[model samples]
Target: MLLEGSTANAVGSQTLDLHRTCTKASQIFSSPGENFIQNKDTVKYGELIVLGYNGSLANGDKGRRRSRLALTKRLKANGVKPDVIHHISTPLVSKALSNKGHHSISYTLSRSHSVIVEYTHDASTDMFQIGRSTESMIDFVVTDTAPSGGGSGGSAQSTISRYACRVICQRSPPYTARIYAAGFDSSRNIFLGERAAKWRTPDGLMDGLTTNGVLVMHPTGGFSEDSSPGVWREISVCGNVYALRESRSAQQRGKLVENETNVLQDGSLIDLCGATLLWRTTEGLRRTPTLKQLEALRQEINAARPQCPVGFNTLAFPSLAQREVVEKKQPWVYSNCGHVHGYHDWGFRKEKGGVERECPMCRRVGPYVPLWLGCEAGLYLDAGRPTHAFCPCGHVCSERTVRYWSQILLPHGTHAFHAACPFCGTWLTGGHEQIKLIFQGPVD
Candidate 1:
């Protein structure tokens, strides 16, 4: 009934008597008359990793005695003695795992009952041998389970050791896909979703960091319920629609704002006012991957759905027939002359009439490049309006002498120039630097 050494590989092929083990363990781990092992069918012998440890203390609790006796008797009946007795704490687990002297480390199961028990031992060529037999010797597992439970044989206390290295082997891949942002292009205006490969999770349950491949696309209509029970919806990256969530909580995750829960089960689409689809993955949100695992979980549970879908350059809702105006529109360069003007296609005469060397009022000249350079400080003129283009500070100054002098005087100060930045009241100094650069080559 016992297994030892490399022969323990048979644990995958053995048939287990989980009913007997569960029944016995149920009595030991039970609280009074309640059977904590609700359903035994949830267990599979091939998946069991039974480890035992004798803690520093021992209690006279009957349940503890029962669990100890059960494990001891079972192993004794099977002619098995546990190969290793590890401390039931993080420090001990770390110490034990750090040592490379475990040559007897082998996974094995019972012949009569299918149950895997991780057998490990002191440094020796015959370390894995059970009762001196590397093939058939039965070994009793020395476990600290009973002592840690105050000899009550109840559920073990939660600790980093429990979830830290708790390994789960799956017949199927834990996740179905993997993806990463190969590149983000601005000139061409394209976002490439990991169109490279079909991503899959590791062979077993892994944190998002291990499977650091994911895409944060905006989903819509409602909360998306995952077929994977434990997996929840995460924000991944909150963009424009961050305010739309009706409510924000761990449970309300996967549910988009202003939509039903049943809608986005598998990712759907729906309208949500004039919102633009904004996306940034958990990876992008991260400056470092040290806490990528927990970070990924947070992303899934707080994912926001985009109110506005991409690909549709739109401003007004319900569709506009003629000319549509957006709340914030920028003026484009005329191309004929380096002037930042209305995006609207004005008649040639009209454009020419307005295309003056200077803004008669401000006296700023033409041949100017669209100055958003000042915007780096958060100042920019509302290209559609000639009024104050910067923040409420009223620092819009496009004059070169004034801007440079201001910056020199107040290094940290910002100005919101008409053709400037929004946050800081600074004029756009974009191409101005190039004009001052050395002329190394022939003049254009």
Candidate 2:
């Protein structure tokens, strides 16, 4: 959240407008040639730059202009802009180092109700005139539990609430390969940005600069570094969206072996501006439709004529004007017990196999395994649901399992899996279930 290199000058000005205009999952445009700075990376040839902030804006994010002006005036008074300036507040500079640019945020809001009796606030007799507000926000999460014998029939009633949320940013294509200096995702199927750099130290490059710089890296290509001679590893993926790097070290090593002319004296040195990087993309994959070919295919799909054969197609045709691109349809993967895998939109559940997901537990007859969503919470968190997975030892345990049991068994969202491996297996003990949105469709 810290920044270096420049002070924001127009704090309360067009910054709000910029924020309002900027949206999630859209690219910020810039013109050519200007040094369009983003994150810690300095990008030249940028005419305009979009700004983003990922996390929530705590009150600490806002600042008054007095502090900025004081530092700038001090720098000017001292005969020059200081190597660095303390926190400067301005929109232009803020846009340059936007939090949204590097990360994103998601939150859920819901409402529930609780009741309590409060004495009325009346100054006439020294009583207070306060009434309890029955409604407020509450968490929607529930864990399975055994129903204890009802104490009093009149237990105060409460409401369960629900809310919407998202966890990942819409990734853009063609990320530069250099951006992957940090690392890549293994299973989450997402990318992470690098952490901010320390600034203004004795060895720091921002010595007198007040504002901070941008940080960027890209990921692509094979996981190998050896490239053949004359073959560069720098390549772009489809749409030329992401830049990738590969290894030419092997080829580079080979070139060293081949005879070559070197006209440099023993003490000579050479300085180079930059070098071109060579790379291969998906276009080179086995017989993928080429760019030109795909275009032609689309045309054919639209303009082809029907043959004189009987055909009954009851397909749901969509209007070209209001088309929404969803991932291509695929069959929903499910367990024999009825746990549904993700699909495009609506989720289908069977009364038997569609049991809500829950955590691992042990039953007298078998092991308590997840059969549906909230399964983890069902057995372990005391979610009053079915006692699915069982133990081989012939025991059916329906008592509410505890959190420690979950930490010793399941890996959260992986509730659809058996509590214990069928064959020789290792248990994935760690963390409680993390709620995720899942969709499933009926079989065609």
Candidate 3:
């Protein structure tokens, strides 16, 4: 899809800046008893948290560019629904309709003929867009995330679309939220060219897909301790579910998944080619652990007084605030054997591809890396003890959390897919992506 025109004057007399309006709305609908009196009546749909960030971005959350964004009821509805369809033979008419400032989608069949679907305001729902674009229309701006919490600007060449996808949430009870493949650009228009994957449905309705496509996977159960990963399906511009394409950018669309729909559930994973997001419903979040609980867990682990078998030095996981810096006393794991020890200079083993270390206790040679506690509380499947760690990048989390993420495969680059550590975005290596920690107590 191609995006054209400048959005600077797109709104004409009215405000074209929904970004400012959304920021204000989120503030006004803040937690109860803070500032706004109507907070008691405010309804929160859910939250979209980008994978790989421990909590906030490396540079910190700024404006709409953040690790997580709360989808709440807007002061005024900004959603639009298809109201009128025009088959115009003239390019002048199509341009005029798009310039009207209202949201629209143009499907160019050929040079002489095209279809323009005009959208009217829908007061019952609110819309939020997610993409790599820094434009005002994108409610949540996301870029590719690198492993080890390097940050969103990790990739120089990103596959994420400028206007990747949009989500619409119903205003009333149930607060059903649905995701679509494409988003309206700065000029509030989505254009599907002739070569784009599009077709008419049996009922004679126009539907299409974005370039790389937007894929979603809902947990088999809900987002909980027992939850398991679901099948990954592609969502269309008209909110239809289908199987994944042969390749990421294949022109052919996949088979329609009649049993599945675009409605989002807790623990739903949305992959935008270059980046992936985890959707946590308000109800699901209530059941998950809070930051205070996670802090207490960290303190509990430190209180255990685990020591290195070789160095006999006490090791502690750093606080959540100290994200990037590795502490000398931090626990280092021999990921191959699940042995935990304090950081030491010895145990170096010669390897061909990368650094390798031989474990003093188990005599197993493998990647020895520092263990960092997964700070993002929302990613935790349960408040269970943080007993397991992900291989390669040893980010420790709850047993279920590590296991769940390790079993699921995410889109990498274009054609390749692999299971990655949700906390650090590192591709899991070897057969066992997750290993049980064997922490040693103080040798007295």
Which candidate comes out best when scored by TM-score?
A: 3
What is the RMSD, in Å, between candidate 1 and the native fold over all Cα?
A: 27.7
By summed lDDT, the worst window of 10 consecutive residues in model 3 runs over 25-34
lDDT per residue (tens digit) for residues 342-444 in model 3: 8877768766244888889989999898998888888999999899999989999899899889989988876788999988888899597988999999988
Put down candidate 1 lDDT per residue, 1-444, tens digits, no spaces. 233443433432432343332221100000011122224333111111111111112332232221111111111111111232121123323223323232111111112221111223211111110011111121211122221123223324311111011111111222111111111111111111222112111321101110111112223322121111111122211010112222221112223332312111212111111000111122222321222332342233223211111111222111111111223222223222232332343233334465523432234443322322221110111121111212211222233322222221111111111222222223334443112201011122
- Which whole-number lDDT from 0 to 100 does residue 120 have in model 1? 30
What is the Cα root-mean-square deviation between model 3 and the actual structure? 7.4
TM-score of each: 0.16, 0.18, 0.90
User: In every candidate, how many clashes are there?
Assistant: 51, 98, 0
What tens digits encode model 2's per-residue C-alpha lDDT throughout 1-444? 133333333222222221232221111111011111244332211011001100101111222200000000010110101111112234344334332223211111111111110111111110000001111110111111111111112213211101110011111222111111111011111111122211222322111100111111112222112111121111110001111111211111111112211111111111000000111222222222232443343234223321111121111112222122222221122222222222322222344365423211111111122221111111122222223222221111112222112222211121122232111112322231211111222223
Worst 10 residues of 2 by lDDT: 65-74
Among all candidates shown, the one with the greatest lDDT: 3
TM-score quality measure for candidate 3: 0.90
- Candidate-wise lDDT, in order: 0.20, 0.17, 0.81
lDDT value, residue 311 of candidate 2: 21
Question: Candidate 2 regions off by >4 Å?
Answer: 1-217, 222-296, 302-311, 314-321, 325-349, 352-444
